[model samples]
Target: MRSVSIKELLTGKQLLQEITVNGWVRTFRSNRFIALNDGSTLHNIQCVVDFEKFDDAILKHVNTGAALKITGTLVESQGKGQSVEIQVRDIFVHGGADPEVYPIQPKKHSLEFLREKAHLRVRTNTFSAVMRVRSALAFAIHQYFRDNGFYYFHAPIITGSDAEGAGEMFRVTTLDEKNPPLKEDGTVDFKEDFFGKETNLTVSGQLEAEAYAMALGKVYTFGPTFRAENSNTSRHLAEFWMIEPEMAFYDLDANMDLAEDFIKYVIRYVLDHCEEDLKFLETRLLDEEKTKPQAERSEMALIEKLKFITDNNFKRVTYTEAIEILRNSSPNKKKKFQYLIDEWGADLQSEHERYLVEKHFKCPVILFDYPAKIKAFYMRLNEDGKTVRAMDILFPGIGEIVGGSQREERLDVLKQKMAALDIPEEELWWYLDLRKFGTAVHSGFGLGFERLVLFATGMGNIRDVIPFPRTPQNAEF
Candidate 1:
């Protein structure tokens, strides 16, 4: 006799032998067949019980969602879709769920309904598969970084300087809210605060990661970052994870190559390692697509889409070139796009991005040399004076999958740019010191972890991929 997981038991290694297993009853239909699952696999093990031998009291407890310990003899199953079954010798009820109250029935539930039951949604097949895929993708990301000689560098969650932009961070304060300290200027006195200055949850770890990358040669950050943007969209989250890798000597072109290789590696990893879960998701996505009109459905299946990205080379185009392509494209000329690309400096919307990646290029597109005013101050300014060496990677459905640039290494140019933006020098004096001492060409990009997950899993909403999503209006979990 041995205790084994349902996954291992189904391998037929314990066939004709007595074994012990622990799991929750997914369904106890007819009181003769108990669908047992331990979260070890998407498939459940069928436990055939002799209802005549067990008392009704014990059988009554074997409801769906009830945790059970079963001692049974593994034998060949005569049922379809299953190879083996358990002949229960004994049963123990560890916990029980009242059928009336248990929300996760063996039926289809809307994604909106599942969000309300976040704690128990993992018991369902779809969420369990989603979570399993999420875990695999996370492991794949770290594996890719480690294999590429990138060290994991952790940045502080509470930071004094805003990396992306100001006014988009959640304030971190321990001071009194009703009657707080005020200065003569009638402003809240952060000088007496816990950190003795203004602090907020970090919106990006790029700045801190750059400091470490300068020393580590290559460094990456994978952690929770907070953004206070009040966007209630499927693509935005109040709290999300970011994957940013900063390289010490890499230029913009090298940065683009790394981004492409890194994403393709992770996606390939998921395709191989999470095949079972991905197949399930692929079928789920196909079903979801069927509800839409023929014109609105996806061009390829879920798994096919993943392979398409890995097999194809990303089309590299300049920002000005992309603008000209979009400006003269049929969509723009016919007024099909919501935001028409009228000029070079115009910000491209999702419609324009999809057109370039999906319709025009038919592959991932890396658009570089963006307008300097639209990009961050840290991005390297091109010789053209009007544009910076900023690049954005756009996938077919996902407009912006990655954003990176060769950083401004020139101390004088960086100061001029900062001064032009009214950013005080003292706010980032240490950052300036890197250039003063021994700064060289360095570049990095940030990949929104949830967005990657959403794409890999063929999920529509950003919240569905994350376990407990933190949105502008919801954080109940």
Candidate 2:
């Protein structure tokens, strides 16, 4: 008989047909019912066994986490939770998971515990739902960009330039670390290395995407990016996926519009397509939040929060205006902010961003025209010269979901900014060539893929969203 997935069994229109199904057993109770899941959906199909028909040895192996193939008759479930089930005819124990040795149990497992057992976590309901939603969201991202006339661009993973100028990069080297060849000046020579010069895992693909956008009119990149920063926060990860879209003739306003629409489109796509997984997650979040104080709880539920984003317009506020508001706000005046905003040039921290999005605006907020000194050198300088055309989209729980800016189209102005920042002009000669030749107003922004998942799934830690999180001193999986 052909094997049918448990998901297919659950959603089939007709029942009472003989079919073979393969899946891991979630639970075996009363030596009669087996909860089987194949990772196709959050729900499992019940498999009923008649103890008198099976041998004692075969029945002994029908425990949780065991792999099984069973030929059964699919029928409407008499059980309370599920709609359909299988009445088993023949059972094959593909693999027996010894209850004493199996890592995943039928009982509730904490998210942290699951993180440690990353290899087997997907067998659980929570991670399976998260990963399914994650996969659907990824497809939604590609679909949104493709539908909008943007060419998908593949930027190099190994790059010679530090696009963000953050100075935090994971060096890609084939040379010996302890001892290396030195030049005449006693400096380690990278010329003898793999690329004949220093190259690192890409921090951001924006620079290369910009190059492609100039030629291709519009392009987007979705790939892995590495960061060497030693931030051990719930939001930080050593390696992550990023979505960056660059366009040739767009300004900061257009960039902001695109970013908002793109986010909403993908979110709506996930809501529509991943209904079962998202519903599971929504219930999971609501149950998790029940432990918190009433004052600290979310005003809206997970589904409501997602729908709110799609229904409302993001509030756009200028950096100067935000500074004025923050300086006068009760939190700043009462000294509640960890990093008080007493001046205009100070960078906004997470506390400030959270206040703006969660409390003041009570929705997604776009903060634009940040101080030139705080932003990257490539961002276009406004007429005021003190601020750059940078915008960061802040969500209620997650601060700075997206960051982007309009590029400096003037060759002389870009060259001057590069010089002022002490960035090697020679290294970016090709990037400079874009401005040197036929540069028009262009804009783009980067969306952290993991963070986006966190927001969509209502996952608290950034680690929980990704399959295997790489963080400080922890690369176990």
TM-score of 1: 0.98
Query: Which residue pairs overlap in candidate 2's backbone?
Result: none
Q: Model 1 residue 20 lDDT?
A: 97
Model 2 quality (TM-score): 0.98
In order of appearance, the predictions have TM-scores of: 0.98, 0.98
Tens-digit per-residue lDDT, 325-382, candidate 1:
9999998999888887787799888888888999999999999999998989999999
* lDDT to native, each model: 0.92, 0.92
For residues 1-477, write the lDDT of model 2, one tens digit per residue.
788877777777548789999999999999999989999988888899998999999999998999999998888888799888888999999999999989899889898889999999989888999999899999998998889999999999999999999899999999998888789999989999989999999999999999999999999999999999999989999999999999999999999999999999999988898888888999999999999999778777888888878988999999999899889989999998999998879989988998998878888999999999999999999999889999999987777899999999999999999999999899999999999788899999999999999999998899999999999999998
What are the per-model numbers of colliding residue pairs? 0, 0
Displacement of the residue 104 alpha carbon in candidate 1, Å: 0.6
User: In angstroms, how far off is 353's CA in candidate 2?
Assistant: 1.2
Mark the 10 consecutive residues where model 2 has the least summed lDDT.
Answer: 5-14
Candidate 1 residues lying further than 4 Å off, grouped into runs, are none
